[model samples]
Target: MPADKKPNSRTAMQPDDASRILVTAIEVGDIETIVALYEPDAILFSKSGRAMQGAEAIRQDNLGLIALKPTFTIDFITATVSADGQLATNRMKADLAWTDKEGKEKRGSVDTLEVLRRQADGSWRYVIDDPYGSMRANLERR
Candidate 1:
């Protein structure tokens, strides 16, 4: 069965719920949804090692990614919540597929790490999103 290309309507108010929302947002090519999942001062580390800080910068970066029309599936590997339950970390393996500029289908796998914080409204938002963390670690092993 093919995956749905729409963001889940359910609100991501919990840490465990954020990953699914992230994947769905990307799959649906919704840049606003992607930005809303992050903290206002969050930082995103791109695959090319570019650091995008704050929601505006992250939104701009996500706009470029949305232009690619990428579809994503994330498999949660592990999650650790802080004692206070205000901070959490989620590690996931992601499969991504997209059509290239030449209309050729491209696919790849990545391991992602997200640090999320509980907001005043009790919603979970990522403070740091590093989608290429595993790739960077692998390269460092060489």
Candidate 2:
């Protein structure tokens, strides 16, 4: 299924919930559910670190990942909400496994960063999602 161009009602009530829901959706390869986690004009970063804008673009990019049938185990590190409670950031560590084209299983871990906004309905949706944001986090750990 394609992205609906709008965040679905099945959204997060808290910042960490957004990350949890997204990882779960990806694990199950639920494209529709995954797209629903982002805002219509959200920015998503591809595995190659390319920036993709809008829902359709995000959906197309995610299709590539879904094809790999990846599994993720995420441990949320921190969730900080703005003083006004309208914006938040979620930081997490994700261990991922997927089958390569050669039918070999590959595994890796990365830190993920997501920025979410509180919708009019009080639900949280991602405005920016960057799986590769771990580069900076990884460097900091060094």
Using TM-score as the measure, the top candidate is: 1
**Can you write out model 2's per-residue Cα lDDT over 76-120, one digit (the tens) per residue?**
558899999999988889888989999999998768788999999
What TM-score quantifies how close candidate 1 is to the native fold? 0.87
- Local accuracy of candidate 1 as per-residue lDDT tens digits, 1-117: 133456765356777678888777766776777888988899999887688899999988878877877777666557788999999998889788989999999998778778999
Whole-model lDDT per candidate = 0.80, 0.80
Q: What is the lDDT of residue 26 in candidate 2?
A: 65
In model 2, residue pairs whose N, Cα or C atoms come closer than 3 Å (at least 3 residues apart or on different chains), thus clashing, are none
TM-score to native of every candidate shown:
0.87, 0.85
| RMSD (CA, Å), each prediction | 2.5, 4.9
Clashing pairs in 1: none
Candidate 2 segments whose C-alpha is farther than 4 A from its true place: 1-9, 136-142
